[model samples]
Target: MANHELLKLTANQVKKGNYNKAILAIGSCEAHGLHLPEGTDTLVSYKLSCMVADRVDGLLVLPPVTVGYSGHYDTFPFTITLAYDTVIQVIYDILESVLRNGINRIFLMNGHDGNIAPIEIAARKIKEKYPDARIAALPQWWVTAGELLPPDTFEVWNGLGHGGEGETSIVYYLFPEWCEKELATCVVPDHLPDKIEIKWDFAELTNTGNTGDATKATVEKGEKMTKVLVDCVVDAIKKLDAVNWDYSSTNAASKL
Candidate 1:
């Protein structure tokens, strides 16, 4: 029952807690679909970050970056998009601030696909400046969830796509009130090749602002996804803590 959220803790509590690691959720504000909320990405990532922090000792959950680059999804209404460089700078600044607070073991939990490149760029910049900083990231939780679960867990497009079955299911489990299940819909892009990566806009993929079989989503699937994702992060953090966040073979070789 220890307080792990930086935003919720007092300075005295934080000092007493002596947290050495932190998590920052990077998410986007965009149209998930007619059924899901606009802040679906942020809500999901932030909630997962909280879940991870709750189980990990000495781990602090920092305030999330709620709005990320969503230019591709701007064809839909009310999408907040940041320029690529701006997104990079924002993430860099946040990470820099976290490092300044003396917590160098950082974990980034990202929720939107558009922010992936920016997160990488920002993390690289932080590493270049602070080589001792041990940073880890779950850049694509959606993909990770699918990989962790059984193949048949999701009934459509492998639970892939914006506001798709997997995404909707998780939201439904975590924030069911935000979802209008009656309005849920999907548009699986059958034309796109399986092997090649296509940089298509959201408009090109689906007219409904979603690209998966959302109707197949359910609370049970969401609950399962949440557990696996949280467990995955918690286990990884414990492993990192076991070595004092020192995974460098060079350091190990020196001891040898």
Candidate 2:
């Protein structure tokens, strides 16, 4: 039942109904930290999407988009980004193509933090085209880190730790060898000032390119966090499906 071999197909087969409910994993190729590879977002998206697909029935996990927005990290050489409008068009075009195949349901599993705006725009436009369309996306880190990591901390090291601890642990659990424990010692910057605009540049935050105290991360913690996130997602999907709002309840549309 966990096999995705039969779930995702080529555009040709998808047009022929060879798939079911669809997912598009949006990720980025940006500097994660000196400890982790630049491909961290892509790798994580693929693994997490597969985990989600296994839990939900009729979910067809699409191959992840390895390249996504990294304008904030553009100062770092490897980082790449797409303009918000351009990405919106790309996603909209994709949904349109999928809809042509008679599949009306779609979800975007966002891996990069910066992909949010464009993805939402695409969702809104797609819904306008097909009233029955159900579209959603979430960057899994928001769910996992928010739940597991306690807020109170004496460690400023922890403050520098996003890529260091939370992200590294998730990767370690999924691909052990690729997770370098030695590199876990990367320095987390404390004196960097927060700017009004979103700082897309990883190097600006720290010379070592780490945000969190990754030394605290462990495989055990990752396993627990992953379970919690998957459970929450499953619950959310059920609740949303049952929301059954009466369109006539409020004349908000009529006022328009």
Candidate 1 residue lDDT tens string, 1-256: 6668889999999999979999999999999889999999899999999999989988999999999999999999889999999999999999999899999999999999999999999999999999988899999999999999999999988898899999999999999998899999978988999789999998998899888989999999999999999999999999999988878685455544
| TM-scores of the candidates in the order shown | 0.96, 0.79
The prediction achieving the highest lDDT against the true structure is 1
C-alpha RMSD for every candidate: 2.1, 4.0
- Candidate 1's displacement at residue 115, Å, is 0.7
Count of clashing pairs, candidate 1 = 0
Q: Clashing pairs in model 1?
A: none
Tens digits of per-residue lDDT for model 2, 1-256: 5465233455554455445567777888877666677888777777777787777666677667777767777776577778777778887888887677666767677777777777888889888888877776665564455555665422344333547666777777777777667876656655655654454456666666567777776787667656766676656655554563122344356553
lDDT value, residue 171 of candidate 2: 74
lDDT of 1 at 181: 99
